[model samples]
Target chain A: MTPASSAKAPFQNKLLPLMLLLPQLLITLVFFYWPSVQAVQQSLYIEDPFGLSSEFAGLANFTALFKDARYVDAFLRSLFFSAAVAGISLSLSLLLAVCADRVVRGATAYKTLLLLPYAIAPALAGITWMFVVHPSIGIVGRAFIAMGIEWNYLLNGNQAMGLVIFAAAWKQISYNFIFFLAGLQSIPQSLMEAAAIDGAGPAKRFRDIVFPLLSPTAFFLLVVNIVYAFFETFGVIHAVTSGGPSKSTEILVYKVYSDGVVGLDIGGSAAQSVILMVIVIALTFVQFRYVERKVHY
Target chain B: MRSFIAALSLGTVLSVSALAAPVEIQWWHAMTGANNDRVNQIVEAFNASQADYKVVATFKSTDYTELMNQTIAAYRAGTAPHITQIFEVGTATMMSAKGAVKPVFELMAEAGEKFDPKSFLPAITGYYSTADGKMLSMPFNSSTAIFYYNKDVFAKAGLDPEKAPKTWPEAFDAAKKIRASGHPCGLTTAWVTWTQMENFSAWHNIPYGTKSNGFGGFDTEFKFNNPTVIKHFETLNDLQKDGTFKYGGRTTQPEGLFVSGECAMIATSSGFLGNLMRNAKFNFATAMLPYYPDVAGAPQNSIIGGATLWVMGGKKADEYKGVAKFFTHLSKLDVQVTNHQQTGFLPVTIAAYEETKKSGFYEKNPGRETPILQLQNKAPTENSMGVRFGNLPKIRDLIMDEVEAAFAGKISVKQAMDNAVANGNEELRRFERTAKN
Candidate 1:
């Protein structure tokens, strides 16, 4: 939260900067803050789906939300989902970035190929993975069955969770890789060579010099990936499992849409959205508060 | 000089017609594939028959639950189409939204359009009508649960291909035999809650709820966790133990398994006939949905599926007239018969059924009469009319979840039924609160 140290020679006129930042400020207020305020206000009322009429319920919506065990289950499921997505995507992307950073031949092609999945839509990514592992016709699913192993995601909750996690992380790996690769390449070459000259092995140098310098980018990516898993993975879940087979894959965000929009429970859906907004805000706050302290930058 | 003179006259005629364009009525529907083409064809027919009004059909159907949700959203935004098709599961939601919809009975009466409530087959219209007998929506495409058995598979399994199972126990026995014959799948069902729970209760002449399955009021409770339903689930769960039955997920997902010549038998929407005719490689025939022969007054009429065209509120008066006229045109015997014969949707009217029968359509197309026969096998009792519950989509998910848990051996069939009732009742309670004031 500290102001950038490099801004010592900042602009003298506050009015110029304020004018420059006005558009973004307005956009955030209208797009983010307005709907957020409405969600909070709507959550306080018992309302029908069509927004035709409403009654003041005064926290009844929140009470009803927590009284249902499924909402709590969805919360825990979301936590596990977000943590796994961020962890797996981060480590895999870091490994790939390191390998690509060391590439001397056609580095651009390697990087381009690695980044291809990032551009694909999340729903399309879910569908592509779905067909590849579909129990009946999918290639991977057929192999599982051929090997005498059970492989139906539509019936099995654990398999459905695993498939969605892999698909969601698979799409996110490339986004993380670009940042990790940039972090690696930005490290001065002299720092690594100096460590080697001091009898440090490559692994030792990476552990000592490269990782610490890359911590800032890694920290930022972790926060972004968690947010991505929380709010933006609705398309993937919708096209794939649809919170199916007994609400096994019902994450908190998907529940909001399923409840409010599909199920026509407007008050409950709004209440869920309010809770999600609080969780995300608290999550980002924690990431900046604690995680930022360790970043070398 | 002759070509220029002819072109000038053509331009003048086109300009004159363009100045007097018809008033457009927007219709949003979810019909897809072959059904989508049929919907457009019907709209074109309506438009061709009128000079002042043109019905424009837009395929705005989203996911199963989304169409109702989208209609509500559009209503709030004041951009709802003049008419939108809603699934039967959402009939309760639409019925309670008095401010959001214009009832078909009122629309027809106000527009002076010739609409007869008695003209529609009661089994289909009963699902969309009020307790005092007012039709809420136009019954466009209606379907009921029907059983399909692969004749080739039945013969291969050493069963009499001509004699399909007429009871639940017999159907299960036949399914197991198909599995014993090394078929990949034996039996499967689509829309499990619809086929097994809603229609199953109706077909058994059992009360699925207290207030005539919510048709009486919005405060109906769930009563499906009885011994009868539990026994049915037990049979299904046992079938899954040896792969005699495959849980084909939800809503037409089983259609692929059945049509791919894999599954021997399936209980799915009669609307699936179109798909079976197109994609089924094996010989298959339709039968009345199997019922428990032990239950007294069993084999009651099956409830309808498919969707109805609802007129949204807030359109101009002239557009309302167009929607009314369109509904009248759509309910014509010929149009209804074409829809029934082509798409396998049940003809909504008694006239259409009699006409189709009189034309020897059933003789030409064997097995096409199974759905109608099942729907009219007996006088529909209170329980057999239809079931409605608010937030039925959510309740269906809960039921599917528990049913899956039972099928996956995470719980007993008794426990699954218990949880389904408990959870489903909770949704009904939430809806009760929403519906009252």
Candidate 2:
């Protein structure tokens, strides 16, 4: 059946269209936009957790955040963390997806096994990694000790950051793998065959033909992975490192939770959230303007 | 007409029974595992004892910070429980939310329950009390930082198995000997801020902050970067450099090091006794927190850690009555003694302490009494009462971060303490602006 077209047969009653959209419109307004607006408004005031009293602080909260060295450090740390997570997750997933796509035997079993990690919760994933690499009890941790490496992520800032990055990237790889496989499969096999008959090696054909065709998926996954690293990986950081080892792993979202929810600094936390929102918006704008131009799609 | 009258009478009877149903008071807490089971037992006992009220306790989270966050969000949304178990660090935050909490002392008195502030341990209750001696929250599972050492390890190192170090220099020397004896981790600690900074300051009778350690007012400033604290951190830094001390993860993660027989000694919360009793395969004992013997009035008294039960405002008068009844039940000698014995929490009431002593419970369990004796050894001075300030959790986080930096050899002890004080003061200032009336 042909999909219904709004252009060919417009709604006879204008009010019916609005009525049809009312539920989603109301939900979006109530849940998403309203909270965003409230965060912006709350950023302008200092209030207790109980809402017993409030004082208009204007831009004082934002000013304090900028002046604070830790907040600035967290912003820069978030950028570095997001970039590392996206880069590692995408590249590793791409590699795995390429290998899995080339397999003709037991491909379903291979794909299912690779996708298992995506089913684990972020916090559980962090906890599992913690167990595997714990300095005292973990397998890898014991191996490191056996080798006399003196591995202790508990006190080492760089080690803690690396641990969190590994956990975060590991969790996102399955998601990227699914998308990359789909993108790779969607590419015309005829083109690769043509390039192969021209005596091009497998690596050359993949580099020249397969890689270019997969740019759109790569671009999309980049945006998604960056966002995931920014906002969703706090659970991993919280569970594994707790932004510890001298706050080396403290990113923007975790800092917001630490200061706002855990510390009960409503105004300061709200201000941080507002700043993060603007950063994400600006990043998205830049990606669309500059990065998307390079994608074939 | 006669059948209709009988039906109306039956309806009246059912409605009356429904109206007379017991008042149900909700209690939200962070206790988990065996401790959570103990909470359920207490609530069940209270529920069975009376028909007027039924208390329902819910375990909200595994950690104090998450529980506090949930409670705060619930309070803001007007769905707060009638009672909440808040950790000791949140004492100042709960106290500052003036109208949001109903002081336990007031609740008890208003409900005409027998609650004598003098009956409670001053050291434990003082942290949650106003300057005027008004107790703000009901002391629940209180604990203090103490020294835990492996007796087996001590014997292996050719040290006195029964004796624990009472001074910093002695502890350091023992740690060196332990390391020389082939111990991988000579010594470690958990709750670094609590055991090292807050309790350390109190145990030495040094000011952690101005204004009676911030128990007096909101204008208090952090004074923990003093020379004594700096010296203590410097000693720790030196030990870390010599492989005598291992830096553990923040907040009780190092307890594993000691449990696994990797660390010979640990300075951590007394409440960790339950876990040690359950898991440790070696002989372990407890001692008072070590102090610098040269300092005057050193080792005065260690302050309470753990949590307290606070009554939330906006609850009904009947619910408040139920809360008062529950608190009274909890303060009974038998209940307190059982809790203190079972969970390693301090007995809050003097009667409970005396009863436990008379029953020879301390004699049966050798190290269980150390926390009580340490808390009762001397009257808490103004500097030793407790550290109380708004935004205390955040301040502790900052301190922990800076201290970790120092321990990691990235910065000097002096620099770490200085940065902690500076950053902590900024947090305190922001808290004052928002929380102060």
Candidate 3:
């Protein structure tokens, strides 16, 4: 294929080319880079909610955050939470996709049903699970009581964390499922048939042929799922446990929201936002550099 | 041609008069449901009573935290409403915003209204007042924590339905009886931080924090780990051990325990009365909050728990005048009484309370006078006035975290309170540093 840059005709008018790119560049600047720069600048100052007065505090906000035991706890908790959510969601979606892929009859119906959950809002998904597991009024809650087990997520920190993780993972499974199914379908059936002719069982055939071929899709999904768990699950946490029963479920993004928006600690929140942004960038960079090397494609 | 000229001149004169329309004032509030309806009723009545101003009330958000955040954002954007209803916990933040708010007392005086701060109940106004007894905000829907018990459950439990527990020990005994009577849950409380910590400290006439619970200044520190608080939590821990006190979720979630007939008693805000009356299938009654009975100077007045109306600054003088007139209209005895009766909020003015009593309203509703009597029972001491701090909402969250830990048996009661004090002090120091700027 010809290189696109060399194949394109030379622009007769430089201003026309510049004008063509203005809208998208302006959008990126205003919506992405400008706010990020402002957040960085705001991290260096302490200001009240009304912005009546502000003082340059240097790195005091970051230092204080590191000293805060709760903030550190939330940080570690978020790491575990994201890992669990990503692992569980990726595995469950892959399993479902494999099962659906083997079905020849009514596969469209099964795929359609599996993809429906992706359309649900995260907060609504959390609420749905919360009601089903509510200590007093939930169906599963009543079953637990009848079985003589003490089940109250409101006071149980572990249970609260588990419930939020489940809800968040449940919301993300459909997205991963769609991607995995598409990847599985795009793989050549001839490879699997050749492996079968070599006296390979289903598991061995999948491991030897299909799974290796799907590694690129899996790698892409890993980064997306980790980022999803880190940022997109705030609504689930907010609706389910509110980082409550003693802050067991409080994630980094929720902390940013509570401190900046609700508590009106503008500088502290802005500092938190900057730290989170850096963490995401580093995570993405590590994924692309290290994880991508394992992909055969 | 002369007749046509006369008609054109008359039309011009009519248009000029229409240009001088009534001044519109915006009121942003967090009230929902029936309380929101009452707000509309009051605004409509005031608008109908006068042609000089028209008040437009807007439901800004569903709850206090969201409302306060929205108001602050709007204030920074230079588009804040003329007046806004802020919860009691936000009092200190509003007061610290110098030049951002106009003192209600000064507004009334400047508007040539005959304003008497003393006409209002001191317990209510003292919460929203300065050291010099100047009212900062108009007390709109002041309420205090009170006891609510299911009368049918009490009767089934062989306890006197006419009398409620007046002390903590008595309440514990009643809870035991209720449990023995096969009730699913014996007792529960809502707003644990408020009803159990803040008001609990004040009802025993003990300090919740230094500097009169932060009303004095920003340098105040939390003092809720006192012996009385520890002892109270220990008793609650024991109650939890025997299943007499069910651990409800934080805030108003436990109110459902009582409403659903699972729990027999609840200690929550009097503001819950309207909901109980509307949704409860069983007969219920209100009573004064139970005290420890052993502490000296106990059973002091309970502090307010509802929101108040504060006039925002940077408005036209005519808008301030309109706010002052609206405040005057709200403070009238009939209006205050109607609000108190309809919404179960405390009547802010003494005259309104007396008028309510004389009108035989309390007599018609036997337990309706409990909140008013609780507020007026004793003059408020420094500790019992109210809590004020810039980061009170965040502090409350810190306390809730530790309290839930204690309830879950992950920590001892004393340890929980200590943790709350330490973490809350850190928050206060942060607020102090920020507020100084």
Query: Of 1 and 3, which scores higher on lDDT?
Result: 3
lDDT of 1 by residue, A158-262 (tens): 999998999999999999999999999999999989999999998999899999999889888988999999998998998889987778889999999878876
DockQ of each: 0.59, 0.77, 0.63
Quote the lDDT for A20 in model 3: 96
Off by over 4 Å in 1: A1-26, A287-294, B1-22
User: Which parts of model 3 are misplaced by more than 4 Å?
Assistant: A1-7, A10-20, A287-296, B1-18
Clashing pairs in 3: none
Candidate 1: chain B TM-score against the reference chain B: 0.93
What value does DockQ give for candidate 3? 0.63
TM-score of each: 0.93, 0.95, 0.94
For residues A1-297, write the lDDT of model 3, one tens digit per residue.
457855685675789999999999999999999999999998999987778789999999899899988899989999999999999999999999999999999999999999999999999999899889988878998898899878889988998998998999988999999999999999888888888998999989889888888898988898999999999999899888888989989999999988887677999999999999999999889888867576664
CAPRI class of candidate 1: medium
- Tens digit per residue, CA lDDT, model 3, B192-236: 989988989889999999998887889999898999999988888
Alpha carbon lDDT at A167, candidate 3? 90
Error of 3 at A134 (Å): 1.5
lDDT of 1: 0.89
Give per-residue CA lDDT, model 2, range B178-226, as digits (tens). Answer: 9999888688989888998888989889899999999888998999899
Per-model fnat list: 0.69, 0.83, 0.67
